[model samples]
Target: MKKLTSLLLAFCLTLASFAQQAFEVMTKKPTPGSTIVIEYMPRNTVLQGKKDFEATAYLLEGGLPRAVEVPLKQEGGIFRGSVKTADSTRAVFFAFAKDEIRDNNNDEGYYTALYDKKGEEVPGAHAALASAFGNFGGIWGLKRNQQKGAELNKKEFANTASQKKFATEYASYLSQSKDAADQDALRKLLTERLKNEKISEADLTQTRFFYQNALKDKAMADSVAALLKSRYPAAAQQTELVAQWNKAKTLPEREEVYQKFAAVSSPANELAKNRLEFFDQVIAGMYADSGNYEAAKKYLARIENKQARANALNSIAWKLSGEGINKQPKDAKAGLDFSKQSLALVDEEKKAMKNKPAYLTAKQYQRNLDNTHNMYADTYATLLYHKGDYEQAYAVEKAAVEGFKRKDASMNEAFTALTEKTKGAKAAQAELEKFMEEGKYTPAMKEQLQRLYIANGGTQAQWTSYISNLEEAAYNKFKAELAKQMINVPAPQFALKDLDGKEVSLASLKGKIVVVDFWATWCGPCRASFPGMQTAVNKYKNNPDVAFLFIDTWENDSNRVQKVTDFVAQNKYSFHVLYDDAKSKEGNDFVVVENFKVEGIPTKFVIDRNNNIRFKAVGFDGTADELATELTAMIDMVNAEGGDVKKGF
Candidate 1:
């Protein structure tokens, strides 16, 4: 009886141990060139209650990390997946995700080391895992620890040869180190290796970039470049040819440079091939600019990549159609020709695509094709509308709107206009009303609808009441969707100097609703988002409890402050621009962005009165009014909420 009780207890303990783990590795003692099977039970973690999950295995082989997505299959309550490793794989790290929510095993991640023939762990397995965790972990939703990663790198790459072999990774490690002495030691080691070792051209190029960009040592970088040029003259000449081509102003000069470049550039070089294609597009644009549509078409024909060719044609067409540029009848005619050509190219490409790429599923591929076709169709239709051919424009635009189900605001506005011309104002008004109710209509669409309503003998009071009802319904719908995306996280404390050198800190605005925007002068998307941000700022400027901080970060120019000031002045923006000049423990600039764990620029955070981040917006893809409306909704929600919200991770 005693033996039986002990056996039962042991069995229960074993089962409990298995249940405690979020994931289990089915493959025992995984080695190089082997398959690893894993079972994930998402009873806990962020992926809890989620039906679909994907496992991404990060395999480090030959000093490079490769991410392989393993499709998970549901088996009872758990998900099962497997991945194959290469013979040179040192380690395999796993991260699980269901859409945006990720399970990174509490940010430590789940991983296994590959073993050698004798069943011992590989020498640099931990080093590979460390690099994967620190460098590329954020891409898979795992938090990065640069200091810890640097320690592991220093421990593994003790010898100069190993450091030279993995020069890029080694340099990244050194840059992360806080200790100046450690950097000096590694720099000396690499200097000695450069003198003694017969390094490859690739390594030399990486080393040169590290010295120039990372270390800010122009002299050392120039010396390395000289060595690379002397060792590989063809590569050096190709680089020079590209530089000359960029500088060339006249068509004949550019043609001469292109001939020289083509002679030295190898077909096997992907970068060179891409550059050649880009040159062809630029030459085509130049011809289009000079109003030589025939010559432009001939130049565009030289581009081998069909998608690139189509995009080039669309860009030229857009430029000529007087969308943003000055309008001319001749330009509009040429634009119509280019737009037709672009749409035809899209159709041909769709017919030729027999199979989707391995990365995208069949549904995703079809959706992509539909989107591309619709976009080109809209361009064609828009050009026709500019040409005053309303009947033909309506025919092309209908395929994009009705056939492909395109819900874009601009596209729908154009469709409504065409509808008014073809199907009468009543039909257009009904269509606009449906779109407004669905919360898919833009401010421009709203104005057009109002004009039609007034022209159709509707009273001003009736129009106002009708629009107000639609807006309220739309706002409620938008709020419900935004509620699902609401999250509560502690806002990282920061103090930055405003443009006038006054210090503004988050602590100072404790009871106020704060909107923090991270931006830079050089980022195109960041600049594009500012107009909407300004709208939001202007809306809340009168509110004493609201504050907007436009923090400038990640600027590489020496005169970044002056440039930022000049930009604001020229744009006539009334923004409270702040400088993100704080340094990390490693002495790296732009600490605020790092502390916030922001992956990209134009990210905004809405902090509640309690100093908790209630909302985080990553990018702007809509109109200025849309952004303002979204921001207002977030602020109102945060303001209305009571009690301390629990942190969401």
Candidate 2:
């Protein structure tokens, strides 16, 4: 009996020792298939515990069965778990402390609850009260120590409720602290709540009020706009509502509100000329958005500041470049000069500001200048082709691209790496697998990557191919928009003289099918299509149902008019060819490039009897037979009166 008592006492001593030195785990959240790194403060007082804490990490499955033990380590104040989950989409985990580690009879050590994909909190995770330095009692600071015979109180806990409370408090704390990361979290939460239809207009209004009046911040204005746009679109469109608030009373504030009002108003409100300067910046934005590049250029040019002027020039250059307007040698030169001017202005700004990033107005001018330079190179190369110097042009392009390569090497490398990582074997494969996950890749993105790629000596073939793809995409996008405006639209009014030298208004052809052919003597395509155009005129000569009007533009040669007259007399062309000499009203209108948006020669627009444009053809790439066939088909279609034509394309 004595020997048995001695053995029992020895076991008790071992258990006691284990309880004194053990480490405890308060709580944990382990993401599946990832290393869970728990960062901690620099100081830790839990290194010398008396008992070994039997804290175990478990992956709960099927009604909370026991899980396999994984290794854990405590370094500094942080304790790390070594277990990782793989494809365990529905797994949960928890950790517990042994009873021997308890300091008080009450259960109070540490507990970790986990969740599965649906985020349901796990159950049965509890830690007993302990006196060790690493335990929750030590971390939280003990109010009092329990005596040897203290009575324990019975208690029940809900893991989900506690986690919810903790998460809410933590978020509030983060938001109050103005942490940048909290912004993302808040955005995500609001977005999710809104998406799930868990938020209402009242909720939005209250939040916006708090943000605007209580918080006195504009950060939430965007959120309010988004909410209004989603819930009350009509209200969102009412710009006067913003002014009704009367809270935004600063000059900048009034400017912004007035600009918003201007945006939705057709022809803009009758803003006084003096007041124009108040919203100059906003006016510039409006002009740019409307594709009124000339207006934008004019307004921006009027600004006295060099920085503002340079910025405006850059903006205009960008719009022109995208339209392929810079492809014209003269326009290309203008763009180049504008770019240089922008760069010079930026340089002056830098000198004035001592190389600081302070010029908010023209901050992007440097980048724009670079882009203009590259575009100028492309335009010059194409112009060389017109000058009968293809070889020299190609040489220039090679040199320019090579220089671009040297300047942006590192950026190119990173871009190449990203592309290789992202691109699939083909466009379809890439698009299906990855493209839809992000956004439509834009010109700015392509330009950035390609410029870098060229600088880094990256694969020219790959870069050039990507550039071509981007160009095709942009062209198709713009062409689609243009086509929407052009298909079956009223031909814009054109005022010009007839063969009788009398002003023949386009309104005169309001009741007949009018075919307008824009041509030039020097254009090879125009010369080639002349015979076909003559045939078309003869086909409808005696019909009295349609009219054919030919326009002669770009008359550089001395005998252009005489040659056209002589040809018309000899061949009986039958169509009226108006001389669009320089400074003519027609010539001035053509310079605007807005009437037809024509970029090439031998362009034609077929108008119906009711003064609506029925069809437009560019370059006359088709043969005489095709032209006649198309014209006949159009006349027959219009004559049938299938429907009234739509406007603007």
Candidate with top TM-score is 1
**Scored by CA lDDT, what does every candidate get?**
0.78, 0.47
Error of 2 at 309 (Å): 48
User: Which lDDT tens digits does candidate 1 get at residues 1-649?
Assistant: 9567546743542342233478777876688899999888888677888765667787877444676878888878788899998888887777777655788877657777777778755667657867766776665666776655554576556656656666566666675565787668557755865884578777677778667755667888899889889987777888788889878999889878878888888898887889988988988988888888888888899888887898899889877876521134347788888888887877776777754553343444566777887877777787888878989988888888875454677778778888998899999999999889767777778988999999989899999999999988988888887776677988999888999999999999999999999988878888888888889888888999999999998886777779999999999899999988745322236778888877678999999898889888887777777788889889988898733443453
Segments of candidate 1 deviating more than 4 angstroms: 1-25, 29-167, 179-185, 233-264, 323-333, 340-369, 387-407, 424-426, 455-457, 582-588, 642-649
Error of model 2, residue 645, in angstroms: 6.4
Clashes of each: 0, 23
What C-alpha RMSD separates each model from the true structure? 6.8, 28.1
- TM-scores for all candidates: the values are 0.79, 0.26
Tell me the TM-score of model 1. 0.79
For model 2, the run of ten residues with the poorest summed lDDT = 148-157
What clash pairs does model 1 have?
none
